[model samples]
Target: MAANNITSTHPAFFLLMGIPGLEHLHLWMSIPFCLAYTLALLGNCTLLFIIQADAALHEPMYLFLAMLATIDLVLSSSTLPKMLALFWFKDQEINFYACLVQMFFLHSFSIMESAVLLAMAFDRYVAICKPLHYTTVLTGSLITKIGMAAVARAVTLMTPLPFLLRRFHYCRGPAIAHCYCEHMAVVRLACGDTRFNNIYGIAVAMFIVVLDLLFVILSYIFILREVLQLTSQEARYKAFGTCVSHIGAILAFYTPVVISSVMHRVARRAAPHVHVLFANFYMLFPPMVNPIIYGVKTKQIRERVLGLILRKDV
Candidate 1:
């Protein structure tokens, strides 16, 4: 069995590659990375500031948006600094334990973000389908509980990942062939029976993603049905309009992810660069685009952001 090849100790450092065949492009690559990070930070921070400062934005929808911004900040911050270091300074040597820490935060935040999206879907459902219970159902106490539950669920599910990794014997020298310390990327280097690690990773990922996707789809189905039954065209349009930002958020959040996962799992013959490209997009695209999409598509956020620029209270 592959488990028999396990060693007790791992190398002190793992060298991360910016891009294997494209090391020459690392500097160039940092441009987009920097742009994504900057936009993600600036946009998410502005959204957070506007949401928190304006009392009128304190409803369930905005509260979920605030949570989303916080998650984006945490998610992007978890990896971008190290990635920039890798690209700009050729600082490829990541401490082994520190890599585990990075993995924990990255995966936990990802799962947490999915949970938040699911909650947002529920918020939209309540607002559109059961307007009478919208405010009463998503009370402060309920939202707090949802927030706590989301955090707890992510932490609980992801906590075991590092420990599972710790037991593996990584005899495959210090180099990780990608820009960051992703779970499958790191574990693939270990020269042991990685079956358990691979299976558990897939199981955990599918567990979260499937449930999140199912609930999100179900909520929207109910929402669409309700919108159709509304008598007036304007009322239907208004109901659907409220969900545009959420729909954008869902697509922004899931598109790259689904692509990446499909490439990794289904298209095993995909080019190495293809995998890397999707991986980068998976991490960077959602965070950078979510805030901008909300700003452009959600009237309240758009107005508030413009108001801030014009030095007028909204």
Candidate 2:
């Protein structure tokens, strides 16, 4: 039998430790997490409603924003509710299969989010660098294709993770020191060799992050070059203005991910709660802030949001 009295080769369930070393503070932590989840729901739903109802927002940029909003909603929903459940009520037991499902959604949606951000960068690049070709380059049909491709790519890459995990025997124990079924954390609880799971997870993460970051950077460089070539200061300013929201979205989404990943790898001796907090931040911050960034920086979205609030057209 395992140290925790778990004897089966594969436990039927696992217990989630909301945040190791922070059990006493779980109630306090739930407050912020609850607020973040509520805000994400309100913001993303409103954003989706506005984009869908307004014919003027049928353009590629707004369409991509809608896609991003959808992803944020799903991505946040997959983790936050369960986390809040664990924190608020101490309901931490999750069925083994359910854990795998949650892991799939979490990882798959994250990949899709990265891909959509890359697509949004391309949209901005074409809109600025090749203004005349924007319409021809990113047609409605093409946008649909891009969205589908992103989903397919994420599914293809993440589909094997649960299967691989299922093949292992979890003799270490049933307790996972994470709020959600994070790949590495779960892998660590298995008795079998975890080198492949470790390497595969890291490789997939790097493949998506590095490639998407490279493309985003390259797109921005060309955008800067094109903006600089403009003779009018106002023209350059206006061109740059359109990208502010996307830039904010990128930073909000990627910064937590990179920080959490680095800390996981290098800060092994750091406080356990610190690592858990960063992981939670990666899931919570982006979804909660993405709509605010867009609503504040994108004039169309801002105006529509204000209009909805004031019950009058701006």
Candidate 3:
């Protein structure tokens, strides 16, 4: 037990932390966390089901909505289950390979989510700006290709990441600071120089998520310009209304991350729990809120979900 106090020079397995200083609050913390996870699973699943089951929703917008829901599900599952295990069962021991696997899935799916959002922005741009060519621009075949390309891009970018970690010497003990196996968190545990991992990780993240954000911003700029050019107030309102849900999703997906990043800088001296709250939000909030953002904001999805519930009760 005394020897265990010394940090390992080469940790074979990683121990994930729940909420470091707030271990006593882990159970209480898990209530909201479990609720968020459950909602994420149920909401995304329901959105997918609603989108797929309703033949009335076979448009490009709704199809893209389905893609977002799928990405949200994949992204949430990558971290939440393992996180819940840590919080509840206290099963923190993860083999080195498994941690690598989780890291890959988490990063890959996050990139995929960004890519999908970019594709959706393109979908909206083509739809609202060039309605005449909307059908031609975003056919079912094109949508399939976009989905495949997004997945391929993420996989290709992430393939080298785990291998990069394999070369490092993790002198620090197995305990990871966060509930999940984040690229930075895992890399930070390494004793050897990790400049390459740091550089590659930051570069890939910026290239993927940041580039997608830039494109999304450009798309919205074009969208807003197009909406403003509409001849009638009603037309302008209608055009902009279609984009409200997408904007909500964009905000939900990105805000927590930006907030967490800001918190990192501004709250360095703050309590660990403050960081833990943001970290959990960064991981959990988007998936939990995306479906709600889409479902409640998109009239079609909202009506369909309500109709389904009514029919089930009847």
Candidate 4:
């Protein structure tokens, strides 16, 4: 049955875009990716469990953390399994609809992650810069509304991508050279001009990602200024300490994305595999490290997670 499905659909490289000289090691190369996938799932799941079970963590910051973990799980799941299948089972063929679905979820979760980061930044800004109004500004209702807005923003931004993709007629050699159905790789297969898609993608990215990053930076700037104004050394330490985890997470998430974009454009030949590896890192690294960041930075979550682990061991 599966063989029939493979034969019926045109064999476009849905995810596993093989590198030029590294095709031979594709299977072996996947070992690190397998490890990454496992660690991401386990770590993010642990974070999710800690947030859910701990009543003290029912605040807006942990709520955003939980949402981020969920987004990471979905984002990683959308790409990694297909890449693993291609590497291990030699099943590189994916139907057009399946590819579209993958692209949608991948992009959606990515946008959502960016939005969540922005929300987290806002949370920090309120808590640090406006401690007096933090309770009023970041109410549970407001957080729920922000979460909805994030989802809506993701959906609205990604709505046009699939429609644009559907208009294109793919040409021969539909092999995608990456590990997953990335926007650039899939669009490159179009026989028709993709200038519009590229333009719109850039516009959307600028609006969503760049704008969110700017907000995060501005929020931190305000936070830092407020922290500096505090006379008490203990108070200053407390203010700075709250943001350490968030700052670390933001760097881990965005730095790889910026690096990947530059690498993709400058080095076209090796870009596919490099792109795949870094893209995976962009999604997985944040999730895997987020728990550690929180554990090291947040006293409540750290103690709860440790207590839970020790209880299980006992």
Candidate 5:
């Protein structure tokens, strides 16, 4: 029943094209990609290490930053290595199941990142708007529960993707036009009708991105109202200052996603390599920028990092 390594349902492997229509530039393109990946790894690791080492950073905001760093590490690692392999060594083949596993980690961690951002927004809102009750509301136990709930939601929602993809019959060749095994890219190779997968994928993406973004915006609105009502201008500035890092993180994470999603729907107008580049950008950009945003903007993280550097120099 298995002919040429393809079973009745799927092929034995999928060939990942590093970037469609830009094969000639793969080697050149890998330089920036590798640099970004390296930065993402080092930056996120430093964030985690500093947060863990500093007892002063055990509060909810910094804990959420720690979570963000952890998720960025996993999320970028999921695809960047394989992408580098493809670009540098021409190792483009991914086993069918391995592709699915990569897809799961990539998407799940991405959703977790979004949820963590929303949690951070809530944290900022409470700190500014309900300062008296901040401790009572976001205790250590509640933060742990929130983290668990984020993981649970992502897992429960994404667990079905692999199963659903398994049902499709892939008659199209095993060549995928993009670097990673994105849900839509893989679904396109299936000869069978993909209406369900398309609908499901869009629905899930909208549910996560839109719903989380709406709440994040709402949280900020309340925060803004509370800040504006403060009689002291200095108090208002201090409150707004606290949210700068979170705002940067949110923009860094969501902007690429939003642009890439929009481009996907209007694919015919844009070139193939453009879409692939944007996909890679969204996957790599947030992780690379997040630590920089926090390190530069958050006073505590910056001071801790400087302290470590000075100690090492001594």
Candidate 6:
């Protein structure tokens, strides 16, 4: 058994030590988070069902949208359930191994989501900017190849994180201050040197997230140029409108991550709580809003989903 006399030397210890007014707020916060999780699950599942059932949505864009929905389901479910349990049920204790496992999946899925967004951006670019060969360019086999490559790239980039985390010796503190397992939080518990983990984490973040953002931006730039060259104002408006949902989804996913990263470095005492809240929002908000975005923007998917619900009622 690990010693129970261990104490945390993390910089945020004082803030987490039963702060006034904030100590018991977890219960209340869990209510909204639970609602968000429920909505995310239902919304993403509905999107998936609509995509699978509607034969008209068998194009590359819808296929990528379905893939995004699937990723959102896995991504949100990874942390929200345990977070809700911790908050609502007062079950805050977690085994070290379980915490590490949770961190692994959380990071892995986040990277995968970033890759999927990049793929979606590329798909849009090809459709709008290279309409002459859109079908030949984004065939089923090509989409499969892109999906496989994204998965492989995410796995390869994240594979080292767990191993690096395992190198540290934890100080036997089982109660994490935040609602969910985070990479920096877990690593801070280590009694050993953590410089390597910090460096590696930053490197992976730059490679997967920063690089992916660059690619997405470039894709959109070309897409915008192509749209401007179109002679028909109606066609240009339609093409630009089709991209609004995707742009919103990307902003929803990446903005919180950027904010959380900055908060982690500058506001050590408050980062854990803010990070947890925003992390939950970042993971679930996209999933919850994505289906609605697509439904409002894509006529065929909206019609098919509504038709299916109406038929079931009849």
The per-model lDDT (C-alpha) reads 0.90, 0.93, 0.85, 0.81, 0.94, 0.78
| N/CA/C clash count, model 6 | 0
**What tens digits encode model 1's per-residue C-alpha lDDT throughout 79-189?**
999999988999999999999998999899999999999999999999998999888999999999999999999999889988888877788777888888899889978
TM-score of 1: 0.96
| Per-residue accuracy of model 3 over 117-198 as CA lDDT, tens digit each | 8888898899899999999889999999999999999999999988888767677778888888888888888876689888
* Candidate that scores best on TM-score: 5
Candidate 6 accuracy as lDDT: 0.78
Model 3, position 68: C-alpha lDDT score: 81
Candidate 2 colliding pairs? none
* TM of each candidate vs. truth: 0.96, 0.96, 0.93, 0.91, 0.97, 0.89
List clashing residue pairs in candidate 6.
Answer: none
Task: Determine the C-alpha RMSD for candidate 1 after optimal superposition of all C-alphas.
Answer: 2.4
Give the Cα-based TM-score of candidate 2 against the true structure: 0.96
Clash counts per candidate, in order, are 1, 0, 0, 3, 0, 0
Question: After TM-score superposition, what is the CA distance of residue 81 in candidate 2 from its true location, in Å?
Answer: 1.0
- Each candidate: RMSD to true structure? 2.4, 2.9, 3.7, 4.5, 2.1, 4.3
Task: State residue 147's C-alpha deviation in candidate 2, in Å.
Answer: 0.3
RMSD of 4: 4.5
- Look at candidate 1 and tell me the lDDT of residue 65: 95
Clashes by residue pair, model 3: none
**Candidate 1 Cα deviation (angstroms), residue 129:** 0.9
User: How many Å off is the CA of 174 in candidate 1?
Assistant: 1.1
lDDT by residue (tens digit), candidate 6, 1-314: 34323322222221122112355787777678788888889888998887897787889999999889998898888888877776666666666567667777888888888988999999899889888999999999999998998789878877787677665556645455555677776676677668888888889888877899999999999999999999999999999988988898898888888887787778878734566666666767877788888887778878887898899999
